[model samples]
Every structure is written in structure tokens, then in C-alpha cells.
Target: MTSDQLVAAPETALPTLRGAVAGLPSYVPGRRGTGADIAALASNESHYDPLPAAVAAVAEAAGRMNRYPDMAAVELRERLARHLGVTAEEVAVGPGSVGVLQQIITGLCDAGDEVVFAWRSFEAYPILVELAGARPVRVPLDDSEGHDLEAMAAAVTDRTKVLLLCTPNNPTGVPISHGRLEAFLQSVRSDILVVIDEAYVEYADAGSGPDSLALYRRYPNVCILRTFSKAYGLAGLRVGYAITTAAIADGLRRTALPFAVSALAQKAAIASLDAGEEMEARVSAVKQERARMAAELAAQGWTLQPSQGNFLWIRADDALLARLVDAFDHAGILVRAYPGDGVRITVADPASNNRVLRLLEAHAA
Candidate 1:
């Protein structure tokens, strides 16, 4: 058609999202509670103030805000490398563990490549995979509300490029045991990258989850993904990292959005690492509270999996989920509810924990 004719015709279409992005489910963040009386326990963030050192570092770093962040995040990556007993070349930093995860997917997978992980785990897994134009193969959780490793292994095929193992998996809060995970690793193809997502590692008891660092040392294909957002209480700052083979880490760094992590975030994360002892003390308190709450919940006749994360998961069918959702809403308490699955309530301070206990006491089976 002539230019005039084409201009005269109504536009048939506008710029559009890729089909993969358009067809994907929207990520639904937990509802935030704004009022004083409201108990905000939905997001599983550490319900504590940022560490003193971290706060101070952020204040110091703020003066440098006019400058661009170090594009390579060399300082932060080096610090993380030293902390994890790896070389700087083997570390990659990003906006969050989820952001690093995005880099991982895009760097490794081509269109139609497959990524396998357990269902009912981190909600972001499939989203990131699909966004990279990769197929997400979800293996159903076992009867105990944890990864079905055998099923996940069985699901793997020639096209599979990655496997994600979320220790102390989100929402359900079940961790993969070291022995089982090691066996699973041996069964899987050597070429596939296995990402051990340890976002809640600090909250887990010493031996509860896979020793991911050790696993990474043994398997070059293994990648360890972690965040400062959980027990370190740096959710708003948005920084996380990955420890992988130098080759893969370099590829992830190359794929990362430029200066995605800020100077303030880098400083705060380094400070948090330096204040490990103080952070450990806070984590110990949360562990005690978790134990107390678990005992009380069990006494109330509610069956729950022992959670290694800083949150408790109560498996509920549709009816019970609806009832709990309504109750929490009316009580001005926010908890994450997964339709057809269950509810995840973050372990916070004593008063908030008591509030949750009282509410659940009334609804126990």
C-alpha cells in the first residue's frame, strides 16, 4: 500500500509484550499492612530494624549517591567471595536473589530449554523461567510438603538446562536434606546447572538444610543463590548474590542490568556481613520464638511441617484457607494465602507471634 493509504488506515496493532511475558501469571506480592494495629506478617521479611553497622554504612554511602554505582560491584562481590570462601571471579551480585536468578535463566536457557523445580516453592521460579523463553517443568511436592527429588530427576530431559532447589523452600518452609540432595545431584545430568536458593539460610538450624557451599565446591555446575533481605533485614535495599563456577558467574555478570545494585546497598551488605555475630543473636531469638510457636501450634492439634525458614506454613485445603484468610483480614493481620495450597505467616516479634497463635488456636483442627 502507498504511504498515504497506509497512514489513512487504522493502526492494526501497537507495541506488544512478548507472548511468553503476556501469557505468564502476574506476580502477586503479599498485601502490606499500614495501620498501627495491623500485624504485617505476610512477606516473611525479618521484622527487625536494619543492623546498626548497616545503617551507619548506608549513611556514609549516601554522600556518594551522586556517583554511579561501581558497575561490576567489585567491592561487594569480593566481600561476598571472601565470606563464602570463593574467588571474586566466582561471585555475581544483583538487585536481589530474584534478579540474579533472572540473569541465571537468561544466561543459560535458550527458547524451549527446560528448567525443573518443585511446585509450591518460590513463586518466582516459573515466572523467571518463562520470561527467559524457557519451559518450566514443575514436579509436585511429596506427601511431606517438600521436593520430590526422584520425580524432579525423572522430569529432566535432554532439553533441560537448569534445576532449582530451594532449601527451606518458600511458603511451605521445607528444606531439602543434604544426603538426599547429594544423591539427587548425582542422578541428574552433569551439564544442567543446579541452583541452590538459600534466601532463608540464616533462619534455618545449622544442620536442617543442604550444606550448599560444600555442594558448590564439589559440583562445578552448582550455583548458590542467597540474599541479605531475610535475616539480615535489608529488604528495602535490594541486594543478593550468586556463587558459581567462574565461567557461569562471569556470564551472569555480563547478562546483568548495568549498575543494578546501588552503592548504598553494597555498603550496607558489607556492614551486615561484618556484624555477623549481632545478626546471629537476633536469628537465635527468632529460632526460639519459632520453637515456642511450633509447640503451641502442635498442642492446638494443627499439623504442620517443621519450618526451617523464618515463617510457618500451614497446609490447608480450599475451605480452611478461605476461613483463615477471612479471620486474618478481620483481625487486621496480613498473611500470605496460596489458593488451593495454604497460608504462610512470617515469624516476627513476640506480640505478633502471640496474635497469630491466638487466632490459630480458635481455628485448629
Candidate 2:
């Protein structure tokens, strides 16, 4: 029988699929260029090229493609542990921080549990929760477009299995205060896991954000998710990790897709760790550029949050945002626009930033 005809037969029992599995939506990555010569800034990525050391490491590791990667990811885990001042057992490396997140959800949450997170955060939280057959309880951000910690804590209930926290939050660029974070953690039940997604932690200024890793030490249920994708300029490498108690790390390691992290990626990440001087210099440049972009936008009467991350969140009506996006697209410049009042622009290189600013000015005029 033909493949199409066989599927049409009612007597054949269809392959069973979980309700959640069949309904799961695919994750959308940040916009990448399909056309030639587009200055894309939709995703908040580092402007500089990958470090020479990382490149060399990846190249060297390419020769070993015949063998499977270390399932335990021992050396990489050790390096990360040393970098974070944690034991190797407390660190779990995966394809990316998102993998670590998936592992955690699979290991800790069962069907019908609830996951609490602030709306307009990483966009992935709710989707991932739903894929796990868990309900996503979203708490709206405060007037400042930051997480409403008190409201989020209050949202916690007996059914809440996990609380996803994003500081210097994505798209909004607001950080939760150390005091507020501590209070929120204390208020939540000890059994509930708190996943602090700190993907942009390197770009966050020292004074504004809380020390989530320290909190992880105090709270056994807390997991700190970090990535090499942002400031490390390894977005293409797909390397990230999680830090938590040994038990949680063990669970993540057990459930994670084996060898999801390529050998080259692991080597490149280890090399990136040693490129601290270069990374710090790039971060400084990004901070300066971010400040300039926010000021330029504000001068044009656009409202912007005091961005702590490497991007600025500007507020404008939906129509205005659409017009700006269209103008930018026509001018070969790309930025992020949400359905609501949020528009995000990352601080790219000086030339790209200048071009983007000129496009915005023309559109505004």
C-alpha cells in the first residue's frame, strides 16, 4: 500500500503519541540572516568574533569527530566548576542552558504540575513547561517591566513544581534586587525548584543584580542556568550548563541527551573560559554602545528601560513599532519587535549601530 493510503485505513491502530508531545510547539530562535548583507540585531549577541584560542581549540578537536563525546562531559564540567567555585558534581553541562532546563523539568516535574514564571521573560519557559504536561502560571511584570517578585511569590501554591526566574530579564532588561530575590526565595516552599536563568549575567553590571549562585548554595532546590552563547560569543557552539546541588545535577546529567555537546563545542568553551581578558574588553565596548543607543532613542522621544543587559527595550505603540520594523527591514537592519509596546535592539559593532540609528532617525522623521 502507498504511504498515504496506509495512513487512511481505519483498521490500522495509529502510533500513540502523548497529548503534550503532539501539541508541543517548536522553539523560535533569534532572527538570522536569510538574505545577503543584513545587519541583524534581533538577538542580543556579542559583536566581536570568537576568540583565537576558541577557534584553535575547535579546529584541533575537529580531528576527533569519529568518537562519541564524553557522556559525562567530565573535563568541561570540572572547568566550569572551578570557574564557578563549585564542585564538579554540582555542575551539569549540556548542549546549551536550555538543555539543562529541559533535563530539570523532565526530572522534577510530572504531568499536571504547575510552573510559575514572569510573563515577557525568556519566552521559552511557558512552552517548555507545557511540553512537560505542566501548566504555566504566568505573572505579569510590574509597571517598570520588571518581575513582580511579591506577586510571583504569592502565585506559588501546592501545585507549583518550579519557579523560573530570569534576572536582567530578557526583552525587558530589568534585574531583580538581591534583597527582593532573597525574600522571594524564602517565601516559596522549599520543595519547589527555582530555576534562575542567568544567560546574560556577564553583561549585567555589578551593582544591579543579585548573586544567584550564592543563593543556589543556600537553597538546595535552586538551579542557576548559564550559557556560553551570549558574552562568550559561542552562540553557534551550543554550550551551556547548570549549577545546583549534587542531587539535582545528577538528575540533569541522567536525563540529558547523551553527547548532545559536540567535542569541538566542549573544547571551544574551555578555551573561551581562558579568553577572559578579550571577553571583558568586548563587554566594556558593548556597555558603551548600549548606553549610546538608549540615549539616542530616548532623545527621539522613545521610552527605554534602564537596560542592564547588552540590549535596550524601547516602548512604542504597536503601529509605530510595525512602521519602525518595516523601515529597518527595508534598510537591511533587523531588530526585535513584540506584539505589545516592546521593541528590542542589541548593541552591535559601531558601524552597525550607527547604521541602525540612522535608519531609526529616518523612520521617525
Candidate 3:
């Protein structure tokens, strides 16, 4: 056809996204605040500044940005191995625990394979699973807002490849106890990979959650995922890791995006691990704040599940949720709102926490 005729004709079909990608729900991040007075209690990020050593390390590593990062993340892996008492061969470092989890899913899951997890846990769980062309099976949380391990165990089929257990689960902030998790592990098939995501472990009180390392030692199928973003104050840098068997860890490394962890992030993570004591002190402060807030909220006649994470979960129906969302927005405070579930307010500094308290006090029954 002539150029004019071809131009008049319809263009060829444009490239389209895969069905899985096209149908996937976008992960909604917490709303960021612009005003100085706005309290950012949306994301469960540490309200404190990065550890001094981490900051220093990032600054020092800035000069080396010209070179690509260690693709294998050797130093960071070795450091993390030492920290977790695992061999370097059994450690894999990625951009964040979420990133490592993506690697895990992509490495293990084939098309149509299944991954089981608790609903209202991490929002990323199903997203990652679907992106890997795997089916996501969600087991609803129990009455206490913790994982329904029995249901999760029962959800598994021969096609099931992975199970994600988020301790002190996000949004809800309820933890899976050691005994329950152990029993659940005993019930599941040994061939399936079980990932225990502990992004908020630093904020959890001792004995409140699973001893993941011990569980890993007992079950080769166990994988422990963690991040430096929360309590270590390295959220901006984007570094996290996983502890798994040597073969599986190696496979995850292969699946990781090349140089995904920047040199700055690697240095910051190493330095943060080195400053463990200082990080622990900060975590202790957050825990204290969390307890104080919980106690005050209880006294206010708002019964709540004991949150093991660094945030508080207020379970609300649609009407109450709308009121709290509006009030928090009007008061220059940002928090995470799950439409059908509840609102999660990060336990920030005393002032910010007080703002949340004042807002909730007005709405409490």
C-alpha cells in the first residue's frame, strides 16, 4: 500500500502485558507527608536516623560509586553469616527482604505452582507469587489476627512450592508463636520451602515470636528472611538478606538482579550489623513506646491485640475505618488503612504517638 494509505490504516496492535501482570493489583505504599508538621506513621519504618556507623559507612562508600557493587555480595553475605552464625554459602543478600523473597519465589516456583501464605499479612506476598507465574493461596488470619497455620498447612497441595510465614505480621502486628509454628512445620511436607519473614523481628519482645534460627537448624526446608530497613534505620539504603540451605541460597543469588544491592547499601548494612548494640538500644526504645501506647489505648477502652511489631493495629469495620482515616488525615498524620480490616499506626516518637493517641481517643467506644 502507498505511504498515505498505510498511515490511514489502523496501526498494528501495541505490545501488551502478560495476563498475570495485567490482572495483578498494584502494591500500595504508605502515603508520604509533605508538611513539617505531618506525622509519618504510615509505613512501619524506624522513626530514628540511621545508625551513626551506617551513615559513616555510606559516606565512605560514596567515593566508590564509580564501580559496580559486588554482584555476589560476598562481604555482606559473610558479615551476615557471622551475625546469624551461618556459613557464607548459606546466606544470600538482596535489595531488601522483599527483594530476596522475590528471588526465592522466582527461583523455586514454576508456572502454575502454588505458594501459600496468610492473608492480611504482607501485601507483597501474593504480588510476588503472581509475578512469578505461580498461584497464590491465602489463608485467612485467625481471630487474634495471627496466621491460621492449620489452614495454611491444609492449603498445600502437591503443586505447592513455597509457604511464607510473616512473624509479627505486617498491618495486623500479630506474631506466630514458636510452638504453633513448630507444629505447623511438622505437619507440612518437607520438600516445600518455608520462608519465615522477620522484617520486624527487632521490635518484637523476646519469646513473643518463633526462634527462627533454631527452626531453620531443625528443618532444612526453613528459610529465614530479614531486613536492615526497620530497626537498623536503613530503609532508604535498601538492603536485606536470607538464610537458607547452600544450594537454595546459591539459586537465589543466581536469580537476584545483577548488582541489585549497591556498594553503599552493602557498606551501610555491614556497618549497621557492626553497630548491633546501638540498634538494639533503639529497638528497645521503640518497644517501650509500643507498650506505653498499647497500655494507654487499652485504658481508653479500645481493646487491641498485643502488637509485636513496631506499630499498633486497630481493627475497624468500614465505618470506623473511614472516620479514623479522615481524622488522621485532618490532623496531619499519615497511617496505613486497610479498607476491610483496620488502621495501622506506627509507634513513632512520643509526640507523634501522642497525636495518634489523641485522634483515637476521640473515636474510641
Candidate 4:
């Protein structure tokens, strides 16, 4: 074997990780492209440029980079609390929605505890659970490509400490209805933490998704996770937060890394909230594009689920998917595809959206 070849270290040489991270699947982000014309639709990021207010806030805060941010994120949390009609103590801000989720898992779980969530939802669920030294129990999606809530409720056992529900679920882009969610919560144990992950809520229609704040009010265990990264075009700044009961929020904050939310991120997020009207206009544009793409794809004899998020899903089999992926790759457009699953194309500018439609049209030909 060469010097670089793998060899097990002697017991005395060094310690190894308990879970041995080698087993964990890597989280693949949306692919990026170097070509100026290449549309980046793989990540569910907003295609719009950052809002003027957010840009100004970031620029102003950039000057204060020399100092550490307020570790507790006092002003940001207070502002979010007022906006969301919750107490400051009920909010926990972190690096991103995923980071805040890590803090949540750490706060709620002990070693070998179980965390249940739908399979093929957010890819991070299992990774975060395992990192917390807990087990991830995956309940697969139903035939409609939506969460099998009844099955999920059945999967719960005494060891289950956390249950995640992703509205406008990642990859598939389906939202769980408010009535369905309320019923599911009623069936589950009160102590089990039900996380309502609304990362794409801004894009979802008013009728489709759960009224999470009302859910949180009725069910104390229900926590709402929201992010500035999606609709606000602040993905680069990485600001996300959790709204929950004061007790749970306190635990989440305790496990967070100090100064994880930078001054720049806090400023940008506050500005994004203040510029809600501008953000709404941008989101409306994305929705219109999504509708147009969905209609055109259907017209081309393609089948896709009704999506409420900022992406379109085509559940292609592996063979066709491979061909489609190659076409997109050669065409210099980036889109997210899961082997043996489907493809998710973010609704972007007309140029990018047209690229996707043309690629599909070529495949059809």
C-alpha cells in the first residue's frame, strides 16, 4: 500500500469519533456554474438580488466587523418577538435554520433517543439527528409525495423526543394542510417536540400550509422555524430563527455557539423584515414563474406534483432522470436531482426558467 493508503490507527495512537462521521451522507448543495448565462436553479435560493434595505444594512454593519456580535442576539430577537407577537424569551436566533435545528436537537435529545420525520424531506434531518447522538426514524412519504402523518404518528415510541414536519417539504415542494397538521398534533404525545419547519412558507399559498403560529399557541410543543435565506434573498448572510415556548427556546439558546449570528446577518435580517413589501413583490414574481413553468411542463406531457414552494418537482425514474440531468448539464443549467427519485428546479428569472423548459422540450423531442 502507498503511504497515503488507509490504515487503522493503533488504540493508543489517537481517539476516534464515537459515531465515526465516515458513515454520514454528505449534504449536497445546489450546483453552481461559472458561465454568466448559466442559471443556478439547484438551490432553492431566491433568484432576485438582495433588497436595497438589506444591502444598506449589510454595508453599514460591515464597518463594525472588528467587534464581536452580541452573543445573545438581543436586538434581533426582540424585534422578531415584537413582529411575531411572541416574547423575546420565546425566540432563538442562530446561524441558519439548519444551525438552529442542530441547537434544537442538542437541547431535546439524549444519546440513543429517537427523532422521527418523513423520509425524502429535508436532507439535513437525519444528519442532525445522528450528530446529536440520537437515532433518526424516517417515515416515508405517501403516494402523493406528501408526508404520511398517520404513519409518522404510529412510528412514535417512548424514545422519540423530536418530530419534524417540513411544510412545502424540501425537494418535493408539497405543503401539509392546516387541518391535517392540527389533527396530527392532536394524535401525537404532548411532550414530543413537533417542529414545523416553514423554510419555504413565504412561497406557499395561504390555503395550503398550516397556520403555524396558531398551531404553536394551541400546542405548546409545536415550534416554528423560519429563515431569512429563502424569500428575503439573504442566503449568503445565514440568519434563521425558531419561535417556540419560552422554556424550549431557553434550552435552544443555551446550546448555541457564542456570536454565531454575526452583526451583519442580524442587520440584514432586520432590514429584510422591514422591507416586507419589497420581498412580497419578489415572491409574487417567483410564484407567477412557478405557475407558468408547471403549466408548460404539463402541456409537454410531463407529470409533476402540485408545488407550493419556489421549485417544481418532476418525479422521473432513474433512466430518464439520468438523460435529463445530462441534458441540463450540457446546456449549462444547474438543477437539483436525486438518483432514483426526481428533479427539483427552482423557479427563477424568465431566462433561467426558459432554459429549463427548452431542455425538457429537447428531451421530449
Candidate 5:
């Protein structure tokens, strides 16, 4: 090829040469409701408004946008350490739990490594593993619609570098039993990193779930992922963290994007931790709604797994599910439909929850 022709070709294909991002699929977010008086229950975000103190904290930090945030996130880590009863060096903060998961994958895996997780748990897990050039091994959930810890443990091989455990898993909302999870952890090799994602832990059954923080202390290779987006009601601020050994925490800090957690996010998270009591109350309300929704759906003959999280999954007939979603849209009430099988209905405020129940009852009748 002539030099002039090569030069022209390079300029023409500039967009393709941007990076190795060509293979990555763009993350699909749940639809937002901008229409007048729409109730959006797509994403499993908390319905409670941010505490006044947290709002003020974020607003105050917004003024310092001109200055760069702390690269190491020292203060935020300190607060999280106190909250988790760990040392500051054992905590690492990120933009969100998703970011933390990505960083963990990057730090541990390389090309050809394998990461194991339950199928249909979190949409991001496989994507993140592949993004890091690692293989994704997905184990099918048990018949009860929860992570089959035994199957997950069996799926692990020598190539397995990481295992992601999302308790009170998404869509299904059923948690793996405490004894089952501990037994699974004991089964896995010590060299493999286990990430226990507790994004919805606050809404899970009180004594049924395992305490990942406690497990982390017992197992050096374990990491606990937590988020402010769920019960804390700080999804907009985008702050989450990992509690692990100091060595794993250091690896995450080194590989994660610098200053990904903003000053406002950090400050707001601190305030949220301080307002823990109020958040606990909100979680209680969501739990009550979850139970109510489950019982109502079960009695209506919709097949459902027992959900311990804020959302309940209903296996509806396709035609009925589609019609229900369309009717809801017409009424300005939005819920998430998982393409072929069923719809996941998250519990909102009393009024919104009642509206949803009434609509379902009318349609079911």
C-alpha cells in the first residue's frame, strides 16, 4: 500500500480507532417517566426522599466543583470503615457498586480467566467480566428461583478467578440461605476472589441472610459489595463501596478510575450513614409492601417465588403480561417487564402500592 493511501485510510477510519470498546454493548437503563403524573417502578430504587441533611450536604459540596475531589477518597473510606467495623485501609469506594464490581474484576482477572455467577442475577456481571477480557460462567438458578449455591460452587474450575454472589438477587428477589452460602464459600478455593453483592440486603429477611462483612473477616479472599442506592436512597449520587482485605482494597483503588466518587457523593453517603435509623424505618415499610404484594399475587394465581427484597416477581402469561403493561402505561403507571416470562413489581409508597394492587385486581378479575 502507498503511504498516501495509508494516511488517507487512517483519517477516514478515525472513529473505529477510538478504543477497544467496539464489542461492548451499551447498558440499557429502565425507561424513565417524564409524562405528567407518571409512577415509575422500573428500577428498584427506594421511594423515600433523601434526608434533608444529605440533600444539604450534597448541595454544599456542589459549590466545590472547580476543585478536584480527593483521589484516594480517604474520608469516605474512614466513614465506611466505621460503619462496617473495619479499618479504613480495608474499604474502597467507587461511583457505584457496579463500578466497584468492574474494578474488582479488572484487578483480579486477565484474558482467558473465568468469572462465575448465577444466571439472570445482575445484568452487569457478565458484561463486566467480558469487558475485562475474562470468560463468564453462569450457573442456572434453583427451582425456587434463587441462586443455587451448590450449582455455583460446582461450576468453578481452576480457571475461575472470581465468583459474584448477589443475595436477594435481582428480578427473582430471593436470597440464598445463610448456611447454604457459608457452605458454598467453604467449598470454593481460597485463592479465588468471592464478591458478595449485598445491594438489597437491607430489605432481605432479618435472620435468613448471611453477613458478608463477617464472612469477609473470616475469609481473606472474600469481598463484600454494598451500595447507597438501595435502602439508603442515594441512587442519583452514585456511591458504593467494597469491604475486604487491605490488599484487595489496594488493588481496587489502584485499578479504579480516579475520582470516580465525587465530593457530593461522598458527603451525601456520610450523611446517609448518619441517618441510618430513618433508612431502617423506610426499609421496614418496603418489606411490608413486598409481603402484601406477594400474598395478593399468589392468591390471584400468578406463580411467584417468595421475595425478601423490595420487589416481587410474577410469572404471568405472555398475553396477559403484555396487556397489563400496556394498560399500566395508559394509566401512567410504569413497571418492569422481563421480556418473555414475567413482570417485576417494586413496592413504592402506600398510595402508589394501592394503585398498583387495584389495577392488578381489576385485570385479574
Candidate 6:
């Protein structure tokens, strides 16, 4: 054969993506509602701007963009270690909670392995499991739209490598109780990793949310996932971390993409941690707003599932969901709607919150 024929053969066709990546459903972000008048409550982002401390930290770190971030994320991990009262070796830092979760899946699962989780929990769980070449075993949520931990336990087989529990579950806004979570933990095998995603923990009513750290202390297999994005108002900065056994943490760190967490993100997260009092105050405000919204929604003749997260859930069969979404869009308010399941409306500022309430009331009347 001629040299030209050999050289051209390699360029004739582009390599195709893996079936998993190509077949993966597109992750849809919250719609940026068209104008200033629009209330975009679709993403579950904190209603407030970044904390002053975080903003300042980001500005300071902006000048250092010329260099790569610290791959180990030593300072941030050390600070998180101090905050959580664990050794640095037990903490794993990543770009976001979802990123850390991806690392967990990669570290634990092999082709044909299985991972168990609640259906209608975090949407990313199944996708991540599939990406890792593992089979996803999803157990349906019980009638109250919360996890049926017993069913989940039954789904686990010897091949199960991971289990995920997203407390105050996304979209549904329902939290698993302390008693229930403990019981579930007791029933599960010790070697399998149980990831507790507490991304919305700060928004949960203190009395309702689980004291998961206490459980983690008791259960060596439990891995607590958290993010600076939700309550700390650092979503754009993309910083998250995990608290788990040193063995599991080491695996996560090893699987993480090098320099996944940026310097600016690290600085902002540390500053957010330092400003805990202010963060708590902001959380308190959101709780109040949630209570008010719940009361008004009930008065308007809607029976909502009890919400512990920063969002409210409305059960809408597919047909109803389409109409409701249309009406909401026309009114300049954006909410996340699950095609056949429900709608998730974030608790935002007073004006935006009131706007939503007013519209719903009008519809009911």
C-alpha cells in the first residue's frame, strides 16, 4: 500500500463515544427566566447572593489564576477536617457533591457491579452509576414520597458495591427520619458504602432533619456528602466535600480528577465556613419563608408533601404538570417539573415567593 493511503486511513472516521456517554440523558439546568420580572426557582440554588466573606475571598484569589490549584486541596481539606472534628485523612474534597459522588462510583464499582438507591432521589444517582459501568438498582419511594429503606435493603445483592441516601431528597423535599435512617444503616452490610447526600440539610427544619453525623460515627460504612452550593450560597464557585471513613475517603481522593477544586472555590468555601453564624441566620430566614409558603399553599386548598429542603413539591400527573408549567411560564416564574411525578419550586426571596403564592391562589380560586 502507498504511504498516503496508510496516513489517510486513520483520519477517515472519528472515534465514537462509549454507548453509555452517548446514550446519557442531557442534564437540563434551571431555565434562566427571560427577564428581571421572572422568578427562577428551578435550580434549587440559594436565594441570596454569595456571602460577603466568600465574595471577598473570591476576589482575592482571582489574582492567582495564573497558577494551577493545589491538587490535594490541603488547606481547604484541613479547614473542613477541623470544622467536622475529623482528621484530614477522612475528608475528600471535589468540585461539587455530584463530582465527589462520581468519584465514589468510580472508586467502588466495576463493570456489572450493582448500586442501590431510592427512586426519585437525586436524579444523578442512576446516571453516575451507569457511567461507572455498574447496574443501577432503584427502589421506589413509599407513598409519602420518601425512601422506603426496607425495600432498598431487599434490593441489595452480594454484588452491590454502593448505596445512596439523599436526605431531604431533591425535588420531593422529603427527609428520612433519624430513627429510620439508623434502622436502615443497621440492616445494611458493613462493607458496602452508604452515601448520605445532605446537600439541603441546612434548609431542613432542625427538628425534622437527621443527625447523620452521629450515625456516621456509629456506622463505619456511612459516607456523608455535603456542598457549599446550597445554604452557603456558593453554587457558582463549585466546592463540595465528603466525610467518611479514612479508607473510603482515600479511595475517593485517588479517583478524583487532579485539581478538580479551584483555588478560588477553596478560598470561598473556607470563608463560608468561618462565617457560620451568618450562614445560620440566612438559613433561619429561609425556614421562615418556607413555613409561610406552606401555610398559604394549604389555605389555597393544596395538600403538599411535607418539605424539609429549600424547595416545595407539588404532585402533578403528566397532564396537569404540562398545564401548570405552561401557566407558570406565562406568568414569568420558573419551577422544576418532573413529567409524571411532581413540580419542585424553590423557596426564594419575598417578592418572588409572594409572586408564586399569588399565582397559585388565583388558580385555585
- Per-residue alpha-carbon lDDT of model 4 for 195-289, expressed as tens digits? 99999999998888899999999999999999999999999989899999999999999999988999999999999899999999999999999
Instruction: Give candidate 4's whole-model lDDT.
Output: 0.92
Better of 3 and 5 by lDDT: 3
Q: Please give the range of 10 consecutive residues that has the lowest summed lDDT in model 4.
A: 13-22
lDDT scores of the candidates, listed in order: 0.94, 0.87, 0.93, 0.92, 0.85, 0.91
lDDT at residue 349 of model 4 (Cα atoms) = 94
lDDT digits (tens) for residues 211-244 of candidate 1: 9999888888899999999999999999999999
| Count of clashes, each model | 0, 0, 0, 0, 0, 0
TM-scores, all models, native as reference: 0.97, 0.94, 0.97, 0.95, 0.93, 0.97
lDDT of 3 at 131: 98
Per-residue C-alpha lDDT of model 2 across residues 1-365, encoded as one tens digit per residue: 77767655587677998887788777666677877678888988887899899999998999988999888889999999888899999999888788788888888889999999998888778788888888889999999999998899889889999999898899899998888898888888999999889898888888688898788878788889999999999989898999998988999899989889999899999999988888889999898888888788778766778888888887667888888888878888888887776678888998989898787777653
Residue 97 local lDDT, model 2: 83
Q: Which ten-residue region of model 5 has the weakest summed lDDT?
A: 11-20
Question: For candidate 6, which ten residues in a row score worst on lDDT?
Answer: 3-12
RMSD of 6: 1.6
CA RMSD of each candidate after superposition: 1.6, 3.3, 2.2, 4.7, 2.6, 1.6
Candidate 1: residue 155 lDDT (0-100): 98
The reply for model 5, stretches above 4 Å from the true place, is 1-20, 317-320
lDDT winner between candidates 4 and 6: 4
lDDT of 5 by residue, 1-365 (tens): 87766654454554453233567666756668987688888898888899877998989998998888897889889998887789999998898999999999999999899999997788888888888889999998788888988888889999999999998888888787778878888899999999989899989887767877778878888999999998999999898999988999999999989889888889999998998898888898888888887788678766778887788787666887899899888878888887665778778887888788878877874
TM-score, structure 4 vs. true: 0.95
Positional deviation of residue 95's Cα in model 6 after best superposition, in angstroms? 0.8
The runs of at least 3 residues in candidate 2 whose Cα sits more than 4 Å from the true structure, single-residue gaps closed, are: 1-17, 34-36, 363-365
Q: Could you tell me the lDDT of residue 140 within candidate 5? A: 85
